[model samples]
Target: MTDAPRTLADAREWARVGTELVLGAVADIGDGEFDADSMLPGWTRKHLAAHVAANADALCNLVHWAATGEETPMYASAEERAAGIAKGPAMSAQELRAWLCASAVKLARGLDGLTAEQWRNKVVTAQGRTVPATELPWMRSREVCVHAADFGTGVSFSDLPAGFLTALVDEIAAKRGLTELPDGPLPEVAAWLAGRPHALADAPELGPWL
Candidate 1:
């Protein structure tokens, strides 16, 4: 198995890969490839992009807060942030893409000057949980990767870095509360995350929700 990304540089690189994949998919946005609704309920391509942009901006703010030793709020307000996501309905496709570009620039600037020590600093998430700064890059990677696919651009978890896949396998396995591997052959964990059926015939139906 590939070694998981255990360092900030590794995580950042993974996040960069996600960024490249997403941006590349959006390169020819006028081709109508993004017309379908995303996996997120009621979200079209525009809303998906906007949510990605907003998340980047939010992460940038958290990084800035960590760097300055001040309590940096990830969201302007709970309502505004929720509205920023929930209100993506108001955005046009072109404007959403622009916002994503702007958000990427802002986040890049925020990450550029951090010292190695700062990379390990902890930040409070908008959801009120504390997570290490080292995890932020991975979180960003997850958003960019999954949301890109959610937009129906054809990217999938298999397209993500191998190390990311390994970590995700660990995560998904844990979330399912599976402690021991099945007695049968293991499935391709990455493909499963991208909504592919895995080990379906081996047992009772897990149904659609799982």
Candidate 2:
């Protein structure tokens, strides 16, 4: 089953937790760290940061579309969006952090003061998938929380908000195709991801990316 966000408030809370996690990691980002490769193959820490911010902006667009009946275009164009993401792998640390902050601010403002009905409105994403406004907050949360762990800043899943860790375990289990809870108490999620497993049960309770 799809582990969609259950409510607008829950989504917003997730967003708040995600933002804190990202900013905490950013606070420790050093000049050389941005260029360092992350767990995602071929992507540096900078690229991951950029991707997280861009996703925040994208989610903001969906929020605006739902709230105001306005089409807040996320990408300049399909080609530009794709190319920009591709170029993220080469960004300087300063550039990446700046972009991330800027994008997040835009999204934060965009989401401000939205009503519950607005948050429940549905919209078609750039990929043509239809989703609720609640999904935007969840998307932002996922990007920041997971990619923050990718930075290798020594933070871990346990460092995340307790609610986030609890919810994320459910998400990971679903993603890994596990339908039943393990026989024993679920293991403490790993602090960081290591490798992919063929079966969900074989994988650690916590998948990497924090």
Candidate 3:
């Protein structure tokens, strides 16, 4: 079995790689396409971009929680999260892109401020699970990598790193109680399990995946 990222440094490196992929995809798109539909149902590319930007800020809240040993929830409420998602599409493409880039950088800066002890401090995830701050990088990485493809650009599961794909499959399977998956590339299998479109044939239908 592939080992999960065991240190803040390792996780940060992976997050960096994932961010690059996301930015590449975002940068390649035309402004007109921002209004176009994405792979995710009911979400336009602008919505996807907005969610991605907001997610970075949300994760930064966890970083603050870790560094200060105080309670900081990812979002104020479900309504706030929904509102944030709705707000992104209305911005000009340049504004949306700038928000995406700036939010990611802000999160990275927040993470870099954490000391070793701070990295060990517990924070509550949006799902309400309490985990160490070290997990935040992986969480951010998942959002960037998966949603980059959801943008419905040329990006696909095959574009992600093999190690990331392996860890992703394990995480999704454990969370969803999936014991078996259809035979296919690991990336495709992971994508399908995450409720994203994949080329895998006859993959079992799954319930909603976070």
Candidate 1 residue spans exceeding 4 A from truth: 1-5, 31-35, 180-188, 191-210
Model 2: per-residue Cα lDDT over 9-117, one tens digit each: 6666777777777877877988876778776777777667777877777776777789888776666579866666677767776777788888887887778767878
- Per-residue lDDT of candidate 3, residues 160-180 (tens digit): 877778888888887787676
Candidate 3 lDDT at 2 equals 46
Best by lDDT: 3
Cα shift from native, residue 85, model 3 (Å): 0.3
Worst 10 residues of 1 by lDDT: 201-210
What lDDT does the true structure give each of the candidates? 0.69, 0.67, 0.85
Model 2 misplaced stretches (Cα beyond 4 Å): 1-6, 71-79, 181-210
- In terms of lDDT, the poorest run of 10 residues in model 2 is 190-199
RMSD in angstroms, all models? 3.5, 4.3, 1.6
Q: Which candidate do you rate higher for lDDT, 2 or 3?
A: 3
Most accurate candidate by TM-score: 3
